[model samples]
Target: MKFALTLVSGLLFNSIAQAGVGTELVADGFERPVWVGAPDSVKGKIWVMEQAGTVWIVDLKTGKKAEEPFLKIVPKVERKGNEQGLLGLAFAPDFAESGRYYVNYNEKGGETQIVRFVTEDGKTTDPDSGETIFQYDQPYANHNGGWLDFGPDGLLYVATGDGGSANDPKNLSQDLGSPLGKLLRLDVTGKEGYKPAEGNAFAGVDGALPEIHAFGLRNPWRCSFDAETGDFWIGDVGQNAWEEINVVKGNKTGGLNFGWRLREGDIKTPGRKGKEIGGKIPENYHAPIYVYAHGSGGTQGLSVTGGYVYRGSAVPDLKGRYIFADYQNPRIWSLREKGGKSTDFQDHTKALQPDGGRISLISSFGEDASGELYITDLTGPVYKIVEK
Candidate 1:
């Protein structure tokens, strides 16, 4: 039986006073999974990334994990304890036809690289077949960035973390010279591998790769595009305080500096302030639509995880809600953005995954062709978000 349209629960369903949320464990029992992807093009396979450098394709129809993997890059990944191994994956726009897909992982020396390839039943190729679309050197481990996604503009977008190690020692996020801690957009349609789209900010610049769309972000963990508006929502994880989520228009300006190591949330960078070198304050920096104080245990297990805007017909109350999660604590939160007033949805979080960690490291949310949403627990499980 096909399970894409069916709703299944993991834990025993506990009906609470909450009106619209449904809870369950759709798929469980696997290894240390990190990221998840289920393109509308692929019918039954729910792709998951294992921290040990392997990809598992789970068939929603059978609820059975594929014995073979869609891709594996163990030989190239560094199995460091906190942050290493295969991290993110994305199927090409023509994946069903071309069978091509992409992944972002930490290589042997711990550098992050975006590699693309073609897949048949369940396997990926090497450097010869899959070229390195982009590569950046990593100073230390931990924040290597998150998933790869194709924006509404049809360009492949990548999110890279600030050069790791406590604060941004390199201040790479603010430096346009470096690609670290930035969001890159590239035209992967034609040309050999990847190229900056024509209208990209630095498209004509001599030295810069046109793909550099926006720079100065500190580990934009998970980002998404609204189906109706095409606006991009970015969840940039904070250092000590303030986890932020910013939404920008489809045709907005690039070169946005998200003030890392310099400014966390709206607060000014300590010591250095006012017109100093590398100390330019973001007077009009795109402020996050929503800001959560890091002090709450909410950010404990709480690295920010991006979720989808509820556009599915299943839940009317959640129709325009922006659902997100904190990785550390695994708590799910929602924000309702309407008429310029962004009201925090506190009722829903208490409703779904109340205890948190029902799914750990809630990496990324998946939407099927029909626009229904699915949540991937970092530890090898997938759940469909249903409304009671």
Candidate 2:
């Protein structure tokens, strides 16, 4: 159920020769690796999320995967489509003491589930200990937006896609009552039901769902907070014509609307015939800081896989650049932003190429505990970003 988009021509072969950064194969042989993360407390261990409901622990020092899974919930996951399965994972801030973690996935009935689990000894999780934290029905399968990460404020932030189907037939992105197409911040520290964080934009709104932190996003494949500055970045997948990357300054409050059905990447998208809601567009719809068309030409990418801003010391040149990739086109780019504006952009796909060919089907990008970046390919391998 990967989002349906028009296929475009591949990147020019010459471009791969121009990349300045290279990638080293770190691990391979897994089923649809969607994400990779490491707990702050773990120095040399990394966890990789396979789309088919298993998390494998990898030892960075030896590059060997553990004999057993760190966590597995295949029985509860629905993997009938490409977009479903175990999509996200986050380690609690105090993971060393509590041995607790969270995950986002599609359950047996295609519903989105956010559940918490605790590892008794800090190595493996007891499958039976899963505590259901949140559940929501999805009308369509493709745009589930399953990405979750803890913000610098120490609250859980969840991203959900606009309730599926082409052209947003239901206009869910504009509906405050619906959790789809929005970013939600929750205080999950409590053992019972979660509560909206106190300073959330909609916390006290009359008819709005209090959990909402921001609205008007399509399928935000990945979003993350800068560990250094606390700024937020989201790579939002676009419809027929564009792909976008958006940011929320560290100081802004919630309730920022990124124009979706009303507009797509700064261009007005007329409502679909017979499904039009005819609502007035908001005056302050946030525009994407960077956008690329869907085509074979320069600066175009099929689907944007949002990544982290490099804060690691290994690659001095990429220190402050935001790294991202295109899932379909299999190209990587580093965006340099200063004072909330994009200052430079570079394509690094060629540098990441292995002897066989270019990295294909990059499903997601990940950050290790040290802030170094990694890219996961749907076929199997995960590569670490390195200086050429």
CA lDDT of each prediction against the hidden true structure: 0.68, 0.81
lDDT string for model 2 (1-388, tens) is 2331222223122233343567888889988899998988887778989988999999887888998899999999998766888999999899999888999999998999999999988778888789888888988777889899888888999999997887788888988899999999989888666888889988778889989988988899988888788889999998877888887778263888888877776567645555553344675677777777786554677788998988988888788888887888777877766666665677777777765756888888888888888889889988888877
Model 1 C-alpha lDDT per residue in residues 229-276, reported as the tens digit of each score: 887888788775567777776636376656675676556544433433
The number of the candidate with the highest lDDT is: 2
For residue 234, model 2's alpha carbon misses the true position, in angstroms, by 0.3
Model 2: per-residue Cα lDDT at residue 197? 85
Query: Estimated TM-score per prediction?
Result: 0.86, 0.93
Give lDDT for model 2: 0.81
Task: List residue ranges in candidate 1 displaced over 4 A.
Answer: 1-18, 121-128, 204-209, 251-253, 270-280, 297-302, 339-341, 354-357
Global CA lDDT of candidate 1, please? 0.68
Evaluate model 2: give its TM-score. Answer: 0.93
**Pairs of residues at least 3 apart in sequence or in different chains that clash in candidate 1:** 9-24, 9-25, 10-24, 10-25, 301-327, 301-328, 301-329, 302-328
